[model samples]
Target: MTPETSETTQAPEGHAPSHRADGRRFRWNKVPEITVYFWVIKVLCTTVGETAADLLNEKLGMGLTGVSLLMSALLVAVLVAQFRTRAYRPGVYWLAVALISVVGTLISDNLTDNLGVPLETSTIVFAIGLAVVFAAWYRTERTLSIHHVDTRRRETFYWLAVLFTFALGTAAGDLVAERLDLGYWISAGLFALAIAAVAVAHFALGLNAVWTFWIAYILTRPLGASMGDYLSQPTADGGLGLGTVVTSVLFLAVILGLVIFLAVTRRDVIEQDRITPQVAR
Candidate 1:
């Protein structure tokens, strides 16, 4: 999930009611508060996703298809655990994100490497898929705010959108970094600049928060992927030669440390405020 602003008390019609009959407002958000820690861990998870996928494909002797199947199964299990929860459990939520990242990478790789699909084609397809998801989500929910992800239906849409973002990011990142021959470092730089632009549009130009958040979230996937490639690919391939094993382990460690900190401190949890009901005279 993308980093989000604080939860708002207002709930659109058809959403889970925010105010109880007693007129008390209760916490309803199912995701973490939008904090710096959230972005840091998200990027780290994306980086790990790229490197770990490569690592598994190399070490496990599993073709892209096999690795994709394994990771997808794992993602399904974690998501089941996630959906079963009434609130966000840091470990379970982040595990699902990390696994989804891997599965997303594998999906793009399978399309390109296994099926001979061009990165450009995959990019277009995933982009269209994501657009359709958003359209459907909004049509059904009347709001796309992450703050409103209190119900299972909204959560389902949220994860579906996230999956498409990762797949699109993988395909687009590859298109620019490899197929277009911009190289990983340059590609990373480009995506970083794009994300910066999105931030400016949101904070300075007053773009919609939800749109900006999703845009930045999608951009980070490629940004992280490029950074991973820059670190993990061979020196001859325009990387620092850290190797996928090292990159994956390094990022995963950082993600683990951050998740532990968040879990312990509860710093990322969304707290609900009590609002007294305004009685009609």
Candidate 2:
């Protein structure tokens, strides 16, 4: 067999036997399984969330509070639907992520803009909150692996961590951009470099998966938000002046196309059988 055919033939042997029978696996759902495609679409969704929130608040004149409230309600509804489902559905999962991303950005914005909270304070607060969440999750379950998120408690922790990451990222990004005087493009570049570093540490340096995952997850928020700001803000604000509406629409289209492709191909299905703890007997 050709090398390609040999690799293809080996793929089936890697899956757990249980997956072959029932197709229900103990893997991440409500989100795309981690792949390059997953990260690309995640960044796109975050960009949409950032720009869409801005459009709703600025162009539509909804104001920050109004847009925040609207998106918060939508996020809660989608999350409820997500929790209700037993299996991962791409449509439901991505919608939840997108909505939560918007709400998360709004939470940070509200603190900084409306409540007069310092970005530093917000960043520290979110970091503490995220640490508490991980502590509680690990203490209760004795594991933080995403592959084992088959129970309600684990899933709740998963979403909570996600929310905190966005909030934390928003604060950190703004801190670097506004307080530290890094321009939008520079901020984006810094965050991109940080994410690359995390990937290197994870794959090359024997870093813990959980730590690597959360670090990269938090970084993506700022990376995406900075890119969104670069594309949508006025020239005076250092952006290209595409406007939030156009930026949001463009990213949303890409997200929709990708989600549809994943749904149809099932390329991200988690293989539950591989998750079984090996016995040393």
Give the clash count for each candidate. Answer: 0, 0
The alpha-carbon lDDT assigned to residue 45 of candidate 2 equals: 79
Q: Candidate 2 on 1-281: residue-level lDDT in tens?
A: 22211121112333433433333323333344688878998898788878987888887678899888888999999989998775677899889989988999999999999999999999999999999999998877777777766556678999999999999988988888887778888989999999999999989998998899889989999999999999999999788999988899999999999899988887876655545521111
lDDT of 1 by residue, 1-281 (tens): 21122233454233354655655444356677778998888889899999999999999998899999999999999999998776767899999999999999999999999999999899999999999999988977778877667666778899999999999999988888776788887888899999999999999999999999999989999999989989999999889999999999999989999999998888887654432222111
For model 2, the local distance difference test gives 0.81
User: CA RMSD for every model?
Assistant: 6.4, 7.9
Output the worst ten-in-a-row residue range by lDDT, candidate 1: 272-281
Candidate achieving the largest TM-score: 1
Best by lDDT: 1
RMSD of 1: 6.4
Model 2 is weakest, by summed lDDT over 10 consecutive residues, at: 1-10
